[model samples]
Target: MAIDPKYLMESYANPIDYWELFSKSGLSKFPPCVVSVAITGGNQGKESNPNLPETLDEQVQQTYDAYKEGASLVHIHCRCPHDPSTVTDDPEVYRELNRRIRKKCPDIIINNTVIGGKWSRNGVMCPPMNVSIPARPEVGSVDITNYTWSMMRKGRPEYGRPQDTLEEMQYTINKQELEHTLSEMKKYGVKPEFELFDIGDLQYLRDLIQEGKTDPNVPNWVQMVFTPALTYQTPDMLLAAIRHMPKNTVLGIVATGGCQYPFLALALILGCNVRVGMEDGYYVEKGVLAESNAQLVAKIVRIAKELGRPIATPAQAREILGLGAPRMEF
Candidate 1:
């Protein structure tokens, strides 16, 4: 059988497409890696890791430290001012935080979470989902699939419950929420950092793109979230996930808890970007809690340097991700 000339040429469309070339040419040809740090997440707070930043001042300072250490992007989850344990829905909180982060790290890409804490009982999505875009993030994380999740954790004092008591949340992110999220992101020019937990999420996002629901010109920024509950983090699963992504996708990898380091290293070696920080995991190593988000950023920087992959600066990251100037200035 004769091979087609069209199949013989190299066409770099997505991160995974580099696999064959990388095998033959080696790491010298790899592009600069974008390191995004989730300084704080909506879930977990000082209780989980005493050093985790839950206040405005702490978050800003931690983010600045990470930025200085080579993190080109930061994922933000602003905590309620009054109750520092729970995540806030108030756009003011988000806006204020973004403004401060901008002042400290002027060029770093600002990303806000779309999913916020629900009333511990009902599963309806609230607050930040509607307000994240209004707060004007350059990127908004949207979980593209609909799923139900239930988890129990130590109750926070702010929840009016005993610290030892286990509080549970059984929530669902459905189609209605997904549609609302996509619409808001489109309106604000916020790039959708689609969080893919499973292969179905990838398929759903591809359908959205095919149906013209997503902006074709904008790069599909995907973060493959690996966790015990969502998608099992394994080398084969990671490879399969990347292989199924649509062309023109910019891939980022993140894993919860213990899987963090190995997957992050794998992401770099595979020519994909990476996301780190306290949001994904609070530890710098096994049983060793990271004192600050910057510590994790510094560790990843060291890994990238060791692998001969240069870390992208904010300007370089913006260009690599095809993002324009800040959508809305504070």
Candidate 2:
């Protein structure tokens, strides 16, 4: 049998044309929209806000409530009950929490955090192991710095007050730890949302992809965080970081304090996603407290709708994140 000339020549044509054709044919619409709820972060204890849940039970309840409100995905950071201030890297902690969350709300997608804890020596860091692949190009690099106020005590205790010292401390991730954490993440089958604090982190991800640890077809969501104390996370910063992102990846913005609205709006406008919760910002607006994760999700839903963008359902979001459809058993 003779092969068709058009089909043979098509292989040499631009990939962009193929993508345009696929998009025009409506194959793109099948992937539902995504709404990720950042449930409980590692930082911000009960002292910061009594509403923040510390234990697994409380975290599960909070996640269930957010799902009810409209969150299809939940970003989780497991905490140690013995020390509310610390973040635990133990897989059991994450598995237990995942189990509870699955039992309560099986349909919601669960995203686990590889970035954990505030180390006096290392500050804030990435997963212990570096996991990246050639096709994906963004999974194995460590571009973020871990810094905390606790480091200030090293020098002049008097000059290094609680707020001042915590704001200035910083640390970097080593290769061994990065590999270990990525291995654990894969073992759990929990999707990871790479948290990038600066443009350097983006470069690290790119290197990881080149090294062959990340999967290109999978939706690797990268979050750009702007904290209140240190540097400002501007719109330009987001654009710069994502300028070189691979086709299968998605970008999200997380503002630590009052900049959530600005960055959230920017993310949506830039054709990216947005994450909001007590973990990112406590205030719904200036001087107003967000009562729950649902309240924050509602606000994002309203914003997306007003901008003519639709909010994604849990099932749809699962497909986008490359997760299996909600299993009642899980």
Off by over 4 Å in 1: 1-20, 23-25, 116-128, 150-152, 165-168
Q: Give the TM-score of candidate 2.
A: 0.74
TM-score of each: 0.89, 0.74
Instruction: Evaluate model 2: give its lDDT.
Output: 0.60
Q: Candidate 2's residue-wise lDDT over 192-219, tens digit each?
A: 5667766666677777677766655565
Candidate 2: stretches off by over 4 Å = 1-33, 89-91, 116-118, 121-169, 228-231, 327-330
For candidate 1, write residues 146-245 as lDDT tens digits: 4445544456676654665433444446666777777877787778888877877778878878888777665678888888777888898887887777
* Local distance difference test values of all predictions, in order: 0.77, 0.60
**Count of steric clashes across candidates, in order:** 0, 31
Model 1: how far residue 134 lies from native, Å: 0.6
Determine which window of 10 residues in candidate 2 has minimal summed lDDT. 130-139
Q: Per-candidate RMSD vs. true structure? A: 4.9, 8.0
